[model samples]
Target: MAELSDGVAIRTITFSLLSSPGLFFTFLTIHYIYRSYLFPYLQPSMSPAHIGVAIFALSFQITNGIAIGGWLGSYGPTTSSNWAKHDLSVYLGTAIWALGLGLNVWHDDILRSIRRRRGVVEKGSGEKVYEIPTGGLFEYVFFPHYFTEWVEWAGWWIVGGVACPPARIFLVNEIATMLPRALQGKRWYVSRFGEKKCEGKKAVVPGLI
Candidate 1:
């Protein structure tokens, strides 16, 4: 079997490789919440519903992780020889992933910058202020970050190829969960900024919701 950069045998797209991007994304999210949102904007508290949803989502993700790990390690053993043939896919997928990651960070930073510009909490009164974000894909979609994330995982799917059911399911699940949230976010933007300002923008996709 061919050895990957991690010194793991590249039999199939293993859990570590498939999961690394997700872990990185999670890291960024958690850091953003703590470093920016949580301390500055939100007062921390726990609600029953919040705990329940967190547990629910966590369980589902854990299940997906186990399934994906199991499949690649045992159920589907892609040979090193097979891996060699897909070199082009590796490079292409990496490029796609990089592009998606770049856009996601850039757009998310735009939103963060907007919030930070006026300070997260107003000085004496302590009112949180918000403004419409601009830059990058924000011009076309209310949630450009969401769309870019889907693109990031699409690259993961492509790297795994057609036979990778685990990757396929993960990508599908991400869309299913995030799509509604994006739509709701669009409604919020419309309410905050007005229908006229939000007229041309879509929920997550640019020009096509």
Candidate 2:
């Protein structure tokens, strides 16, 4: 009886940890879909190649969902042990992700309202969209969404615990690949909006990098 109870408890805990990362990433995956596929498809200067790259990057994280889910199922212990220790890092990390996501939601709503007021609908498709901005966070940073996204994965890494190679790989790829794009994006915005207006905004990190 004792062994059986322990086994069930362990299984439950492992399952929880394994599932938690997937859930966090899911929110992000959905967020990207809403923006890339559903929202516009209508950027004035956006090219087919740019759209393709965007889709590739957005889909990359979602693809990890399968690997993560599989890891939890395979190596996950089926018996309760001393491994069920609570880490405050996980909670704090999750909170940061939630906060970033919340900011994005609010920002989108504000931009959407502004577009409605401006009477700017899609060119021929009739879908509604907010135009690219020169104000708010956009006034300072070109890729706030990318910034929050980086933070979100960092949070996932924290909550998902150490030695999670899959999470580390995801973070590494994002940093290596996206960081350059972010810098380019910053330059793009500056060219469009002027550099003087973008004071005090770092490229990726707040004050550094």
Candidate 3:
């Protein structure tokens, strides 16, 4: 077996590499909750359902984490033939995800600017109107976060040279869980912003979905 200069076994290296996405996603879920939900709650008023959604998101994240761990643990490492020689696709996909994440930040900043300009006045529902987000990704897609997430993990699989079976399993699980949530969120957006705002925007994927 090929050995590292430090005498680390190739199996150890491969296993660790395969497990990286699981750990990364775990960290992301933690940070996402704190930043997205906890920070919003620090204000005087926030809807109970918003908190509930946060909890639900965390719960799903936990399930996914466990699934990833089990998958990686079972597979341990990917052999060469297990995945196609498409390493370039892995890098390209990762860059796409990074761009999506950057756009997410940009979208948030724009919302913050709008909120600041509009001032923080309480709405009739006792919640601040248009405080979170409802344009760009929010308007165009219900779960851009999840979209980016799937893209990110797709990159992880590519980079690790993981095969299609595990990737398809994850995809199926995401569609089962997230698709309904996306549809619900789309309905909420339409109710709030009107059908005009959501025009030409698909629920999850763009066209061809």
Candidate 4:
């Protein structure tokens, strides 16, 4: 959004700066950079379906970014609206974002440490290991990473305030898409470890899903 950040209010500038790559730098970007080493079992070759999904996801993200950027630059709040009055929201959002990101990284590290200890694939057999995650929020939910991501974006929405449709849509869309995937992941865990082992853990939400 550097190209569009000429004369936006300080609030908008700060919001964009934090919510831009800062929202994902701790997880998504880092994860993708080392994805090959981390997930050696994944094929190097991309299928047509993979390409299609990538195109669609990229397009959607770019469109969403533009929408949010445009709103922050022109259509949304400015200093004229007495931004100081809304400081609470921005402060609260920043706290929530940090908390969410910390939890996400911690949970991810737990899984990675497990992989490091147990090894990703068994020798000779070439079978992948699937361990049930423990520690922190994993004791309550199957997909704490996904849940914390939703939390991160929920903070994004709060920082943008109630009037920002783009921020609301962004957070809502993330939940809508990730929720089903989290559910599927829970089912996969159940299939792998059996229903008995996964009895207490919910999909994404604790005691809910």
- Which candidate achieves the best TM-score against the true structure? 4
In model 1, the runs with Cα more than 4 Å from the true position are 1-49, 118-121
lDDT of all predictions, in order shown? 0.68, 0.59, 0.55, 0.69
- Report the lDDT of model 2 for residue 99: 72
Q: Deviation in angstroms for 86 in model 1?
A: 2.4
lDDT by residue for model 1 (1-209), tens: 66644455654553343353333234334434553565345423222557777788889878877876665454543445555565566567667766876777677667766755556356655876767777888888889988998887787666655566887898899899999999999899899989998888899999899
Model 4 TM-score on a 0 to 1 scale: 0.75
Sort by lDDT, best first. 4, 1, 2, 3
Model 2 residue runs over 4 Å out of place are 1-63, 76-83, 109-136
Q: Each candidate: RMSD to true structure? A: 6.5, 6.2, 6.5, 5.7
Model 1: lowest-lDDT 10 consecutive positions? 39-48
Span of ten consecutive residues with least summed lDDT in model 4? 20-29
lDDT of 4 by residue, 1-209 (tens): 33334565454434333443233223334433444365344333222557777788889878986886577566665443444555678778767866876787677677667766555345535875668989999999999988887787777677667677887898788889999999999989999889999989999988898
Q: Give the per-residue Cα lDDT of candidate 4 at 37.
A: 61
Model 4 / residue 61 / CA error / Å: 1.5
lDDT of 2 by residue, 46-155 (tens): 32567787688668757776766544444433322323442465577678767766666555555556655455446555675444454545544556656666777777
TM-score of each: 0.74, 0.62, 0.55, 0.75
